[model samples]
Target chain A: MTGDQFPLWAAIAVSVLLVAGSLLMLAGCIGMVRFRSFYQRIHAPTLGTSFGTIFILAGSVVYFTVTQLRPAVHEVLIFVFVSVTTPVTLMLLARAALYRDRIERVQDVPASKDPLDNAEMQTSKKPS
Target chain B: MSRVLPYPLLTLSLLIMWLLLQQSASPGHILLGLAIALLASRAMAALQPEKPRVIRFLPIFRLAGRAVVDIMASNIAVSKLILNPNSDMTKSGFLTVPLELKHRFGLAILSCIVTATPGSAWLEYHPEESEVLIHVLDIENDQEWIDTLKYRYETLLLEIFG
Candidate 1:
């Protein structure tokens, strides 16, 4: 317990990590704006969710552990949960978009042609 | 019974989350967190989301273990490709694999599993067509990717969550 206060070195390290995380998050947001298509733009948030959150959580783990002298790694839960959930949302959104596209016969995405594929797919769709 | 706590499982998670975040077990903290959890459940009741029923528990653990290992390996692979641009990295592409599981919870789990793995990302799924569109970091063998998804993830998810 280094006096149970945030040491100057820990403060500097945490600040640097926070700034880097924020910058990565900003770059991801920029990627969302710059990308041309929805599919392309979907790649942007991975930067924030994957490496960005990892850095922030690592900083939290370090700051708390160093200051408190007892391990406080539970904040890693936030990082893990967010990383897991973001992809799920993106997947569902993409699926919804694809569903709409197929219904409208959109030309952007390639459509499958096999009848067996169609039958296989039909077995999974239950009317909601 | 009120629809608010239709699932006590979520309530347990909320309590655990509160404790973890606070990193404390003081009586005052526990009381305050319990209040918050109750209020949050009330709010959730308003949404009226369909409650997911998890059937098997053991397979869920196995799936998580697999996901952890795969994500770590994929992270190394993707990092290598990013570090060395001309290391003969295969140009990324998409594959549409037909699926058998229809339950929303199972599908959601599948999405998380696919996207969290660094070298691949879940791009889309067509519910009407029952096919999932995934973008691979390296796209050399489309069949291999499809096979991996079907066997590695879809199989276990169907068994556990479906």
Candidate 2:
């Protein structure tokens, strides 16, 4: 079945929603490029994950459900998976960035305690 | 059960994805999906990644709900800043917050949550020190960001996966 078979009003509504969502995603991509710092740019992808994926998935569900005359909730899984995974990737990237900064001792970053300093306390032998 | 579905969750999700994409509930389609899922799980099993033990699942739902709402709110706020060029809403900077939870799986999940949200991005982490560095879109107050991440996310993640 094609989208044309669906009611014209429904098609228009879905198309509008999809377009708006895509625009949001496009804006996010622009933000990535316009932002100067790596950390600053990291916020761009969330535009894609937060509402970008949701809108696209929503459109898919609406189209499928309307055309087939059956409810389609399974697409919720895509939303679930993407929302969950995007954060994980971002966190790792952030941590990696921080590691690089600390090792280099970049100025302005707050000082952190050395967890390794306590390792000798747990050891059986005394320090030389 | 273990032999048949090396990764039960993965297999089930694969099967669901297959059905959703195919939009078919026929017996033949189900068989095909099962076969694909089985093969996929086998491939995944070969990776030998450390198995994540979920001590509490309910907290995960709460965490997810909180994340969704925050992301949405941040998205709106960031978009407004982007739309207005004249405004001085562009003070972006990195932040470092100390962490207590050390589990790799939990840390990974935390990273994703931070990155997925707008207005802030996880930039780096130090395993030895257990500290996370993040970039905030508009850094009006630094302590606010640190406290939010620690109290809002770290607290719940510790309950769920720790």
Candidate 3:
């Protein structure tokens, strides 16, 4: 946010990055409404979470490093944290959604997956 | 070395995370961060998660680079699909992809890659069947998508984790 100390080229680059990141995020939100199915809607926010955040974080890093005269790659923690955690959340959510759809005997659910019964809803289904 | 640091890599990363958060490399911060990292690593060791044995290191970077390129490309594609009025929305659907890479860690990384990209969301992984169910935002062709998953990412993952 503190960009007054930034020179002309840095300002342009940061602004462009920040704007592009915001636009990607805006499109992601719009996608939540634009897409119809719950499954399809799941892919929307990743636009913001993945590269959108990257661009924005890059801008922040550039801004801070230039302004403070220090390496501001700390935002990499956010990137690493998100990359590590978002998949777990999205996978669980998608599995729960798919489970509910399968249980309700919803049409168009992938036939390859067996319908979950009350007893079989375990998270450790992966073969260790 | 192994006795003092049960998980050297995990402890090192935690220490680095603490330093990054503090944004300082001062001696006081380093000692404090080391203590915190040791404590955290001990706590993590209590959970007894199976440490992934990465057989090769180089392909890991290659896979990451390829995934980055794909992410950017898909980000644009999905954004265009979101914005265009005349875009065909019906092409989006679920696809069952048969996977050959079965290493648990490899599968975990694959899930991250698939879900981290904009145009796809990994729905369910069938470990028993060695297949995964993924939802594609724009499924122009099922075979093409399958090939992309298998060849583009899975092959490199096999090199790194399999």
What is the DockQ for all candidates, taken in turn?
A: 0.21, 0.39, 0.67
- Per-residue lDDT tens digits for candidate 1, residues B45-162, read 7788998877888988888888877765665555454445355533666677899988899888888777866656786566788887787756786777788788988888888866
What lDDT does each candidate get? 0.72, 0.78, 0.85
DockQ score for candidate 1: 0.21
Give the share of true interchain contacts found in each model.
0.25, 0.64, 0.83
lDDT of 2 by residue, B1-162 (tens): 878778999998899888887878799989999999999999998887788998999999888898889888888888777666675645887677899988888887777777777887776577877887677887887888888788988899899876
**Which residue pairs collide in model 1, if any?**
A95-B125
Which candidate tops DockQ?
3
iRMS of each prediction: 4.4, 2.9, 1.3
Best candidate according to lDDT: 3
After TM-score superposition, what is the CA distance of residue B52 in candidate 2 from its true location, in Å?
Answer: 1.7
lDDT tens digits, residue span A70-102, model 2: 767666867888877787777767656654555
For every candidate, C-alpha RMSD to the true structure in Å? 6.9, 6.7, 4.2
Compute the lDDT for candidate 1: 0.72
User: Model 3, B57-156: lDDT tens per residue?
Assistant: 9988889899999999999989999999888877888888888898888888889989988888898877778878899988876787788799999999
> Can you tell me the CAPRI class of model 3?
medium
Worst 10 residues of 3 chain A by lDDT: A119-128
